[model samples]
Target: MKRVLGIGLSLVLTLGLLSGCGGTKAPAGDSNAGGNAAAVFKIGATGPLTGGAAIYGNAAKQGAQIAVDEINAQGGIQFELKYEDDEHDAEKAVNAYNNLKDWGMQISLGSVTSTPAVATSAETFKDRIFALTPSASAPAVLEGKDNVYQMCFADPNQGSASAQYIVDKKLGTKIAIIYKNDDVYSKGIYNTFVSKAKELNLAIVSTTTFTEDSQTDFSVQLADAKKKGADLIFLPMYYTPASLIFQQAKSMSYSPKYFGVDGMDGILTLENFDVSLAEGVMLLTPFNADATDERTVNFVKKYKDLYKETPNQFAADGYDCVYAYKKALEAAGCTPDMSAADICEKLVKVFPTISFDGLTGEKMTWAATGEVSKSPKGMVIKKGAYVGMD
Candidate 1:
């Protein structure tokens, strides 16, 4: 009888031990396999969530979140996303990358801006983590980085495309360019635009530059363009400086036809910005929220309903980035239980072969060099809204 009791007690103790072992949670960065919780791929991104460039960052985060929510609801493949604020700083971006790495980020949305993307791209390459940037359009962001890709048009492409569109439409006779000399994004676009303009025999009347310190005062640059009889001004910088330039130009009553690149997208939403100053502003961008396509209409409606504002090109690019990732991951048959390196390898192999159609572009394909091929659309700001220039 005593021996029977001992055997029963031992069996109960063994059962309790097994139960405790089963209840032990999986370590951080490991996919939880127990229960009905679906395994989710972890995606990490870093952008300027609280600085001057917060508009771009927040737009990207929200857009990507919407994609994630939709995908999660579908119950096919799920994703967990986390975005860190880099404040548009390169050093801070590197720190953010490290943080994401520690959190077991299986994939990365590199950065919203070029400088930070450039900084983080190196770390991703070193760590064998795949990255797809929504709006970091610099060539250097993809240079020597096979696992990194871009969703937005590269600076060179934007510059060359802008020049071609302007020439094709006969938008201006004499073009003047004002670019930030210190910025990689601005300088890259400026160089390509000048090359393309010259190739097309377009007359360039004035070319001026500004550094970060002198961006607020564009009076000298505008005066030079006006003096040179420039009928149109091309701005390859961001919206902040562009907004100031518009104000300064309006103050002097020098209203030439203003043309901009993707960097000028958020000007319409700029706080305290007078929409009248941008009455006829033209920009070469990939996404037009006012597009009548069903996908665009739905995305715009959802964005407005959730954020209470219109979605911009950056937001569209971010949305496209996630969908592109989804397509590639689905094509590659990647599982959430895979290691980050394995996911990176699968994505790097699969991205070149898949064609993605998203809010920003249709039939978008990535080159081996990680540059995305997509046509840009011309948008004109009319009555405080972006109208497709067609």
Candidate 2:
């Protein structure tokens, strides 16, 4: 049983300019309109429905769906969900966008990771549509744009929180930071973690970068860390590689305590992973399945009943992201003139000072820098259970 805290307000983002396209105001649930009969709004997602990153993408999809369901149930503004699979590729995301174009979708919830998010951001800006990513962590997504927004915290905040977790706990003196070189998401997280580690006075034993698609054989990195006598390792890679590295490290009888950024998830897929191997591994993430607040508990129950599986962190963020938009749309009075682009602009102006009662509890008001100011909680995988670490 996990304890729940207050809800938090998430990140604020400015999107790109909207093209002056003719807008349509179709009646709710018109199949001719390419939306559900009961839906007042239709949102699309371009995510990896299949492929290695599907776990993360699927979680995002589920989260968006949860929001749609909740909003429609209350009979406020009926919302519909549309999902497009990009298979975690940039080119495919464009193809997905073209598909949604025929469906007349203007507000999208997609592009889980940075690659697709970046690609879609350019295209959505060109189309003047509003694309909100709940999981994209790269800062470049928000650089001088007005149509894209991310609900999840960026790597800078997550990295700072992770570093603080180690420092606050006095977990280790020396740490190894492992990251992928070319990937924007991994690189962004690595940069933030490095900067924060220095501020926290944690000695960086090694700064190693790996090719995004290539394997980072732990042998070389571990040998280097062993040489430096490091006490902890911060592997800032996504789940696929992180799991492999963990297994490889265990094979070498190397068991330094581990910490990671939000890119790490799906621990159940790790190889040769027993309870002991994952004992002390921790991550700085917004998704906590163990929340205990009334809304959170209700959300978990409703989600499990609908999806027949437990909800992940990305899903939670997605649910919150849609609701945040819904709140702003409501404030804007969801009129025929109220386009997603208008809501996006309203989001930038509204988020800075608004408190949201989210599924996670009470989220703090949005920060002026476009990030959430709420304090983050830590979770450790102890004995196969994710427990909130104090």
Candidate 3:
């Protein structure tokens, strides 16, 4: 729903050096001799295949697989996918990046979530590896790196968009918040939301916190919000904790209009959780699988047929990220065995001024800052699925 409106800033990045990323490139005269159709364009991916963030990570992995299959079928250049499980842990992600580099991976499509992406991008920044993450939105991931690109908007932008959505919709003036205090992504969005809300003259009725390792019981927080007479509640945590909050809130009979961000996107897929609990829940996200556009309908049908489940925002972004790279490669006439520097140069030079009609159902463009310039859409859950807020 959020099509990039106009031509974005040019993408001109200067990757420091690439001596450490694979060996030197082939001589100019030997372009197709040591590169191109025969050599494998190794792409490494890392995500949480078995942990709390597995929902987000696994969705991205599946989407990436779909893109890989389609790309290989067309047979432009040889490509290989090497996967590693980071478990959503920063240290584990670092290990995964190291393993991929050891295995001669030239490009990366991971680490799926923000925390891991931030950790892994540190080394990639030093090594100048070209990485385009599907779902990592924390600001830390792209602070100093020229090679790291993101498909999703950063937390600050998402938070501002959430505030704008609430204000524009006239949802409520009195807002209550219960956020994960220990998590990077949660804290980033919460701070920006609060700041924007204050600017818009919205009242903060209640503010509560919970750490990842803390108790799951949110009765106390709900009771506090109820006592404060808050009409709307914002829960900026992942679907796992948000589900627990909803269940406990329902038990306490504390019903308030619920607002969430992309972190709560996987709520419908929670194991054994009743789908009705998500009814009327509003969120701001990158993609909505139930959209009616030709691209969206085709993607949703194909994704469900392949994975036997609906695709999430992360899935859409993952699919888009691969196609973005493919477009850049095609523009630069890149071969499979180009040096990391050469590949990085091609991406930087080719991405600007080029727009992609991506699987996210948008005509998206890249910013010079390594982020996409597409707008965020507001969506609401109804009848056990997400639909446009319009």
Candidate 4:
């Protein structure tokens, strides 16, 4: 778990040549579109800035800011990111959407949870602005919508992959899946894991779900799993609960082969939990470039130099996504008629061919379902560092 150091707001505003065509075109004769260009092209983000999910949101924002800064520095496209604090609440996410829409932002990357993301998507697509999430893994959020895309693989894949790994490792004949009942992200992954375990003929001794945003101890849950002879514990909840579980289990000497999906980001920050508990823990995530190629090595060094922290998958996705957009923009010829919607359309067509020479050495492409696809990479936490799973 990397320590999240708070950094002062380092928002940089840069100007780009805005173009135009019609209703969607640059507001007629606008300075950038005409002679005097404004100092920004706006993108919006809405995330939990002051709640349990703040770490995820802040990390994502930092990543996006880094991407925007790099883009602006290269004089490719200047992006102004209007960040709205959604407080990790769905209603607040809706509010953020309305506000950003009213402010005329065309793209955004945020809302850590699925419910808020789904709500925000409904509002955003109505306004024709696309929301590209870095960590929203719930498949339900993207059903029937063209404007919402998450750069990470869907939860189903992560769930199934984790289950398969557990089975292959022979870690357990019976397993317990601890999840948050109310979270779409958690429930989706949990259900998928259960299905996969069953397919592998593993006995699911117990499956339990707890309330979200609660602090009840996991002693009862852990005892139940123990009593059921469960040898593996699958937690599909986000960082906070997962950390709590790890801490409690360590206290009780209740070690099970821990398995999880990508939602476990930031678990490294749990001060009391032994980092060794993370050893052999299996979680599925997009290939981290640092785990793969030389290009990503350079990018990581550059990012750390700029932000004083190693970049996470969210930031890497944002960086790659911007490049994806740039390729599409150039493909569309940056005409006056190239509305954001047009760009998105071009993106859908071009995305399949756009390969990421990402930190994760795997070549990435979108499966027709809009979920990013690449060869599976296992992230095994070992000795305070995430080592690539073979």
Candidate 5:
């Protein structure tokens, strides 16, 4: 796992926009508008600032801050982001949301991963306080909610996409799954993949699982998968466990194609792990920092210059979401002092009509079901770096 350095609080917020059309636009002259006197829109962002997922939370905060700074520099509507760390715990995330709301925040940008985002949304599901998650992909996050929105392809979609990628490449007809039965994300993707693979007439040779508290060793599961002659092994979990699994698989001389999802990102930076362990490992993500498109190239450069490290998918999501929110606010003619309910109502009406083109290098839009229209890219690790699949 990547070590998270302590960052000062005063350093984080440093503190933390305008356009108009009548139907979707509020008069800049409205006293409730942010452009007016002493009206600063407050966005409360929650994520894992500490604990196992802090790396993702830190990236989200940085990307949001970049968007905040850039928008503030434009000198239109004023904005400030009040961020709270949930430590990647669902209950803690809910507490953070309540605390931010008490602190006067009307909008939210994240609860970085699916578990926490789902938790936080439960509290805001019927209210005006809207949430836009950066990386959470589980379908339940916004199942029937009107005020909540997702910023990535949902887990089920990702699973089906992975299955399609396998068929397209003719990589295998037999697949094995090794996932965490206790994790919402891993289990959700596994269920979808199993159904999709079966529908595609592919063979599922082995299905294995481990609880979150289980021992690190996966010897039994690995032996079973190998004995079943699996052409691919799916690891639907985060990088920490994924790294240990890779090391053990290499030790046992298992050389099947390994597959994963966005959570497998940052595997190359795992402490003391051999990058070679990830060679030929394939995963799905929306953003590749090294992508050559103009938007991708510029975002990567800005991210590297700001943090001295390449941006990950979560970071790109955070950046794009901020811009998306700005567009939504402008289109809805929202002002800072308007009732949270009204702001969200207007946004809900405006969202389906707009397309956002940002760091993801595609025009993204939302469905009435609150799903973000996105396609996952099949990426492979080669020479210790992510590259588009050949």
Candidate 6:
């Protein structure tokens, strides 16, 4: 009986040691923790996952996931993505960035909006991590950050391109502007748009502004634009305020041709929004879901199948950002085991030398200044859908 008991005890100890040695996996972000760590790279992103701007954040997250899935399936490169919620607040964005840093994020898809992106980008600059923002168009996001880059047109580019598009297409004559004065994204676009419009000799009839605390109502601004005899109304703001402006204008019977920049792309997706209010609305954007190219058709079909809605410019931007990173990584011959600082240095040296064709644009190249070069397409809302105007 004593001999049998000793054997049982020895077996129990052996089993316990085996379980301790092989049963647990490493943390998701630690590349040196073993178990295929060298075969995959960890990427982190932060955006407004649960706020008024959730549309942009969720779209970007889903879009990037699709790209990561497709690339991993090819069995050549692998990526693991983790996204945190910033709720569109700059302070929360900094916190989110710190969380991602703790997770050992090697590459970053910075915040979806400009203000949060500005805050997170500064941290990335300090940490020696590379960041490529999808829709953060404010120039300040990349002003002094050499390791930061953009996948969407910057505000100044959008503003100047918008003015040129309006003039080239003869869309309207007298233009009135309604912009969010306190937001860097809106104000940056507004300043550039005004300068370009002045240079082009475009007639500016009236100008008005709104603050975040006062965005729910636009009675005075609409009334002034209507009274000024403006034929076109330019909205350099997000979809939320733009939607409100549209509803209020219709209620007052003050209808004018409406034009917006990329910030207006998600208006149609707004919950309880009346799509008819946006009919005949025009905007300048880089991606159009209606394109007949095989790549675009496949991407659109996959997106709609998974997301239950059409992808917007923000989604396209996110998808392009991942593919752009992939291209730059391959060109630099970067390995998953490299430190974030090493990866950052390699990417910074290689991004300007490679051209990437993505869902957003073809042959897109980045400048040393972190700006992307691509042509913008004119799109109009027709029958509750975006149609190419070119």
Q: Against the true structure, what is every candidate's RMSD?
A: 3.7, 12.7, 12.6, 10.9, 10.9, 4.1
User: lDDT by residue for model 5 over 1-390, one digit each (tens)?
Assistant: 223333444444443212221112223323123332136667788898888778888888888777776776676765677679999899999889889888777778858888988888877775677778888888888887887888877889878888878888888767888999988888888889888888888788999998868739888888898999987998888888888888888889987899898888877766688999899999998888878888788778888898888888888888888889899999888987676667778888888888998886477989877889977788999998999974
Residue 135 displacement in candidate 3 (angstroms): 0.4
Preferred candidate (TM-score higher): 2 or 4: 2
TM-score of 6: 0.92
Model 1 lDDT-worst window of ten: 29-38
| Residue range 195-276, candidate 6, lDDT tens digits | 9999999999999999999999999999999999999999999999999999999999988999999999988889999999
Candidate 3 segments whose C-alpha is farther than 4 A from its true place: 1-38
Task: Give the candidate order by descending lDDT.
Answer: 6, 1, 3, 5, 2, 4
Model 1: CA > 4 A from native: 1-38
Per-residue CA lDDT of model 2 for 137-216, tens digit only, reads: 78876666666767777777777777888899888889988888888888887788778888878789787777855665
lDDT of each: 0.89, 0.72, 0.81, 0.68, 0.80, 0.91
* CA-RMSD of model 5: 10.9
For all candidates, what are the clash counts? Answer: 0, 20, 0, 10, 1, 0
Best of the two (4, 6) by lDDT:
6
Off by over 4 Å in 2: 1-39, 269-276, 336-345, 367-369
Model 4 vs. true fold: TM: 0.83
Clashing residue pairs, backbone N/CA/C < 3 A, model 5: 17-77
lDDT accuracy of residue 322 in candidate 3 = 78
* Best model per lDDT: 6
Native-to-model Cα distance after best TM-score fit, residue 167 in candidate 6, in Å:
0.8
Q: lDDT tens digits, residues 1-390, model 3?
A: 133332221111223233234534333222122433235566787899897789888888778767766776664654566678999999999999999888777778868888898999888878777888998988888888878888888888888888888999999878999988878888889999999999999889999998877748888889999999998998777899888888888888888999999888888987898989888999988798877888788888888998889999888888888778888788888877687667777776677667887866467887777777887778899989998887
The superposed Cα distance between candidate 2 and the true structure at residue 166, in angstroms, equals: 1.3
Residue 48 lDDT, candidate 5, scale 0-100: 87
TM-score of each: 0.92, 0.85, 0.88, 0.83, 0.88, 0.92
